[model samples]
Target chain A: MAILTGVSMQNRRPLTGWGRTNATVAEVIEVPNHEVAAAVKEAGPRGALVRGLGRSYGDAAQNAGGLVLRLLGSAHQAVLDPSLATVTVPAGVNLDELLRVLVPRGFFVPVTPGTRFVTIGGAIASDIHGKNHHVEGSFGNHVRALTLLLADGSTVVIGPQQQPELFWATIGGMGLTGVILDATVGLLPIETSRMSVDTTRIPDLDALFSAMSDGDDDFRYSVAWIDPQAKGRHLGRSVLGRGDHARLDQLGPKELLSPLAYGPKQLASVPPLVPPMGVINHATVAAFNEVWYRKAPLHREGELKGIAGFFHPLDMVSRWNRVYGSSGMVQYQFVVPFGEEEAMRTVIERLSVSGAASFLAVLKRFGAGNDSPLSFPAPGWTLALDVPGSARGLADLLHGLDRLVLDAGGRHYFAKDGRTTAAAIRQGYPRLEEWKAVRDSVDPEHVWQSDLSRRLGLTD
Target chain B: MDNALGEPQTILLLGGTSDIGLAIVREVLSPGARTVVLACRNVEKGELAAAGLRHGGLAVHVVHFNGSDTASHEQVIADVVAQHGDIDLAILAFAQLGDGAVTSKDVQAASEIAHVNFTGTVSATIAVANRMRGQGHGAIVMLSSVAGERVRAANPVYGGTKAGIDGFAQGLGDALAADGVHMMVVRPGFVHSAMTQGLKAAPFSTTPEQVAAVTAKGLRAGRRTVWAPGILRYVFSALRHVPGPVWRRLPLG
Candidate 1:
């Protein structure tokens, strides 16, 4: 392993992945071949950010002035069991690579979000959910066990049967409790690479809710791509898509040959000039939404679409975020309980009325969240928004939404947040006292901290 | 410099001639401290050093501080605080790293290194520690060494002095914990400065510039002890636990 000193500072210009909040730190440590144990020790007790494919779209993988373990280049030794449909993978393995290797062997990840560029470790840290979360739960649910390196510089294996407290604490711990070295996760059986999808464009918010509540169980994966510009009676209007993996009998011979690979070129894109406009004004957003809803393939059920086109359509565009211009963008995701859907509606309405141009709005049904104290998930309806960087008062606007989140008995996902106040955080995560006690007991010197820790009073 | 609340801080360096001492002062005295008193035995040399520091953009003053004059430590610390409000940092950099073999044969040389290095730092650290505890915020940087890990036959006197300072600084660090006072004990190996001139080059050779950078990082990280050529930190861990029989056979200073 090459030990590059901070004295031999690299002159590379500062580059931010997706989260464009904090200023870049000059003294960056890039341990090319450092062992997991050595890197953990070098972080002292302060902990480190284990960076993978850098697909977080936020600060989940950024650590300023602190060490960032680029685990992407770390060792890769995966063991797959075809019969049991489980795979033990190194934390740094990307989802795209994982599925490519396993899907041919008749298995697939139980749940995956809109992107296949994320690492298995990142998926667990964020506890990401897909269209089928209402039935299969979040990614943490599929995890059988995790090999964790605790804050005390000791290694421990955690699972439901052993070290249950630590296991639950780490399920959605967001890399705070420790660094996940590897995971043994269960995979679901898949018949073919294509999805038997059913697409519907709900005309208004009422029909959208009624359609989902009435027919959600008929499909394995369900998602609603909302148009945030819709206003008045048209508020919450969306193009809802749901699907189940196509069985071998359902697929034609041509689909079977190249099972999972995306079809010819169903391109995903947006106007390049739209991102720089910043505010995503109400007038402009309304026009965009009207066109999108009208463009949805009407009444298209049992449509044969490849896996990538069905589940991860956005993966087609390279550096798709450039559409948001130089300032980048923020992925604002929050959850409200079924009873609090009204509160969720109000927030959506407010965002639209305020001209928060959010082109990509994803709505998912989340089941029970993991027991991790700081984990941000609940049995609720979650709405995620992608707002362009040009929006003014972005921080203030998010703060306003944070209050609504706190009021709706919901907590802001630390992995997605960059500007939440400490006071609001305290209100959002009530079990923080318990986490603090554990953190203090293991680290009496108060050594482990991060940008999020300093911002949200996660540490003393 | 500035305290946590933005108030201007004050500082005094007892052995201003020491390179490591000046490095610590240079690292911690920016943005907050309104005054700095460089206390040395020779006023003329101290004035010259202070003038150079002033020319380089620092508020500095020269004063007399003879480490052998033990009774004067309390008064020196008090005078600096009186002239410049509260003393936020008081550095005990007065020490000598002379040849242990030569000092062993020369009683006068051995006594000077012991009294000036070990005793002076102990007195000054205690004096400033008390004042800072009462006022509720101050940091003390004591210059120790890797030689302090074990007393060696090659440089027994110098090693012993470092050992004593290391022990004192550790205790002071623990004692000042709840009182809002902090202590940073620095240990560097084979530093390339006037202190190590004419001596054979050793492994992990370092410069004052490197020492300054690490010390600044340590202060910001709220570290208690900073080791220059950071690898020595792991080296000392093994040396500190070695038995006397095994230690005596090792040719280490």
Candidate 2:
């Protein structure tokens, strides 16, 4: 008599989600397009979990016996208001789709991550940054408004001008603030997809920092490829690169066909599920590191690289995470203020001595701090690494790194972190208590929640 | 957590052979939920879906459950609880449907429908609810429908049965409110399932996938009710407000 609408008595199998972290739920809900608000209300707050593209490096998207709101296909794109240089987009709209339409219109996002595949909501929640954080700041800085569905099923519009407290609290509060349904974001003008390029191989950490300090003002985007294998004086050897939009004059007569059309054929290979204990060993990574470091030109030079090639090299392989196998992997990124740059050195030293191998090691100098309380960037030195999540002793190693990062007055990026302890998270996120106070006032019943919320003890 | 590093999820499907039910199980249970307990009468068909879900990485087992076998219902519940420690989630999704003409011709058909629909639910709920209530918490989703709101001659038998279940779940929800025991009654309009194979798309007809998605959300939110094509909540609200005389004259079934 109880009408079970879609219960497949024949196929009455309970389905789940993509993020492989937790699997405690008995059932899953795939709401119709644009129904996150009503669905949240109907789901009625047993500590719900909101999921984006399932691309988070860790358990931020996982939950146990809790409600998971998968927003990607549930919400679609909204109309753009060109006059205001702004667009009203659903929280589910991925960045790639947004940029494809915006890039040709002479405007672009001020900050974007390595892959434009992330959702706008995920971007703000994570407050992701690109190589240009040295100039533009994190994605939250470009957001103008956020429409949130609170725990009690009430909706509120928060932004810098409206509900400023909730705005700051939710900016990087993860999904703990509420389900982000839509938002208005300011866009930057861009002439083309091409980046007028430059490259320089700095021999040592000192030279690397000095180059960034002196030349960062000259480029719109900047980052350094660090060699973690290098020891002693050459510990942080790197290749520095800086660029801006390519001007029409910079193109040769033959290249003038579409001077700014800079998307190149992205060609990269991702292995099928990594063989148990597969290729990312110290010997393999050491060899790869040697070749990469040697390939950097010894002298400074300017070279033209397509935007996608330069910014999103990882996007080439569609499901590259499989390369790390079923255990998955973590992208460890942390920022220590300039005064505590030594912390970066200590981390590198620890990784080197432990023989922990990482494929991608990047170093960047962050610029001014944004007003969003939990924003990750500051006037500091940031280092990011892609280390295997299942690496033996990874938990203890990461715990040690957290201690050093805290002692250095720094914090880990929640967006990319999966294993941080609640105490360590509190120490890393200085503004968390302030954000929690705001969340407590709005979601007094404490309904809005996610896997990250439970992991960090941000909710009951 | 239902899964370890690479293990699949453990699922308990109450009514094992429902086609739309299985499709939802396939769509959402993919690559996770390793152990699946299919409680059904035909152990063979149950084994088939179990194998299918297993091929997708889930380990499935078949147990016996007859909705009309009220006396055995308690034992079935006890056996499942004994075997699985505490059921992570028990999908209470069993029901009976009959062609309107046959149901009108033979009141026996209506009685059979009620046997599986209302009486069966009450009997099974008594055992399952006790177990869940005693366990301190778990989610129990009963499949309900929009037709349950008002019975019409077109399918009065099926509709009346659903009406009883819908009301029972509401009351059961209130009773279990404090025990951390939850129930989600899904009210989907006409669905394009095997049960309605040749039926044309009604104004609100939806797919099994859509129903599963909404149900998943309802389960996650710990909601008491889930409506597929969610606008049905307001639409039904308006229907309730229509005067009895006008409602009776309406041609729509």
Candidate 3:
């Protein structure tokens, strides 16, 4: 596989998601812009899926016993029109790569996840949501139009107004409907690359809930980092950060000189090799959470910070996932309806009592969901956590949580979920049948497939 | 695909009537919806075993398979894969304990044991491994034994065949690793199953359930070899280096 041929097909290469769980092998091929249709035509029985940066936490990007295509798309060639406020970029262009090119041009991606290493194709496939999801909706909302490679080797231009059904289905279809070639995404205009921020460390779940529910509407971007192990009176203790783009007038004389400068620093990178047992176990996570909680400011406002510092702090240390070691990690993200705040509280309390060592647990509110049935976000309270993949009784704990989440009319995020069942997905997504109708209409023979799709019964 | 936690969706058990094989399947599929294909020589017994497993959420398909029939291995595997999409896990537990002392002087008896344990296992495993390799990812659990670690004088025929099969499985595992197929060789000291019903229990003897539990852990951890009762791994490690003359004098018999 290290040696490349003219066709660029690496046979039987093992792949895993960012979580590093459930590794599978596929024949990875670098399908060029023109050959995407050809790859679709020649995709064999197991079919084909387009992988981008391997950012999705689960098997959404992996096609077991099939072809995985990496399209050659670059952000350097992006077409940015400040007038219409849109950028037509290749699907393989990562958010960071695009940000480097676009931020200097006085524009920002409408939505970005915790990590900026995600591809445009992956962002749309997962319908990835961010802190701004409560105000701007998910990534699919800003996509004005997208070019797709269908099952029969035919390409189609789909948009919200044109072929909206197929368009939305492809949005969060987990790459089951078809492969996205490129997208014409609407961008958000910004005055500077710096963020004007506010930070608050709430003492308990009750106070944190009321604070978030009250203050979330005021900021364009808002999120809270909850310490999952904090229990009793201190249950769900968290630090909330809310922010928006810093205005030119907000910057000082020195900062105003190069207010649009976008040089995000990489302070350190985690070494590739780590201990077999991993460094992120219960004791270590508990200690880290305690120190992190004590370190956040009691209350602060309008603190000017770099965009990456505010959004992608974890991205500063590359290969950070290696901390989870060979056993890898399991990420569980589910959103319960607004009224079911009790259920969300119960999930937090249970994890606190169980002492399962969930790291970087965050809680947020999502705005109204779009037409995409498989889309993860909704008008609710969403909680996401990452735990040790090899933790004892972790599955049973998550399975129990699944019942509570589903009972509360909540749904799990496909991009972040690595261990949920199809039954749970069936309960979460009421409009799943409708989405399947559209997907099947396009992929009658079911050419598009993935391990996640099969596990969750989204496709064969 | 094995779920993110490495729980398989479909399982193919070559020895349908094996307690350890069924136990491993039970541990993995407990109360969860999954498919299990039981391929064994005895259809009636396999059905009975399948019935026991059906209490939990499982689709148990009892298929006919003759371990001694080397020529039929390929077709049997193909039939299973054709009926069931692809096997996520395959358990090769079909084995023969030759009657009496075959390694002493009876060449015919020795051949009978080798025919199934060594020869049949090699053919059948190759058939399944090939399919698993094509299927991209799979886990194979071969029920080798502690006796195979060093062929014992008390049960030389059974030990001899296991020794050969164990070596073959290890070699096959290395080749299959590049194809995303994992192989786990289970070496159990003794098991109080129907196969060893009347035998005197050894000090570190284990039940089928114990073996199955270890098998499940090994598969989850992607381990190449697993020892039942856990301590057998360390015990065998030390025993592997023991002087032959001193080892033979220890009252193992």
Which candidate ranks first by lDDT, i.e. highest?
3
Candidate 3 lDDT for residue A452: 84
Q: Candidate 1 lDDT, tens digit per residue, A257-342?
A: 86655333436554456444343555566677788889997678888887788887778875576666555667788888778878
DockQ of each: 0.02, 0.04, 0.68
Error of 2 at B55 (Å): 46
- Candidate with best TM-score: 3
Candidate 3 wrong stretches, greater than 4 Å: A1-10, B30-33, B55-57, B102-107, B241-249
Per-candidate TM vs. native? 0.62, 0.63, 0.96
Candidates 1 and 3: which is better by TM-score? Answer: 3
Quick one: ranking by lDDT, best first? 3, 2, 1
Q: What is the number of backbone collisions in each predicted candidate, taken in the order shown?
A: 4, 36, 0
Per-residue lDDT of candidate 2, residues A337-383 (tens digit): 99886788899888777767787589999999777777788789999
Among these predictions, the greatest DockQ belongs to 3
Q: Which parts of model 1 are misplaced by more than 4 Å?
A: A1-8, A11-17, A26-34, A44-47, A73-76, A258-287, A441-448, B1-253
Per-residue lDDT tens digits for candidate 1, residues B30-102, read 4324577899997887777777666333479988988877899899888877776546667787777777678
How accurate locally, in lDDT, is each candidate? Answer: 0.71, 0.71, 0.88
Give the alpha carbon lDDT tens digit for every residue of B136-157 in model 3. 8989999999989887777888
As for candidate 1, its clashing pairs are A278-A390, B1-B32, B1-B33, B2-B32
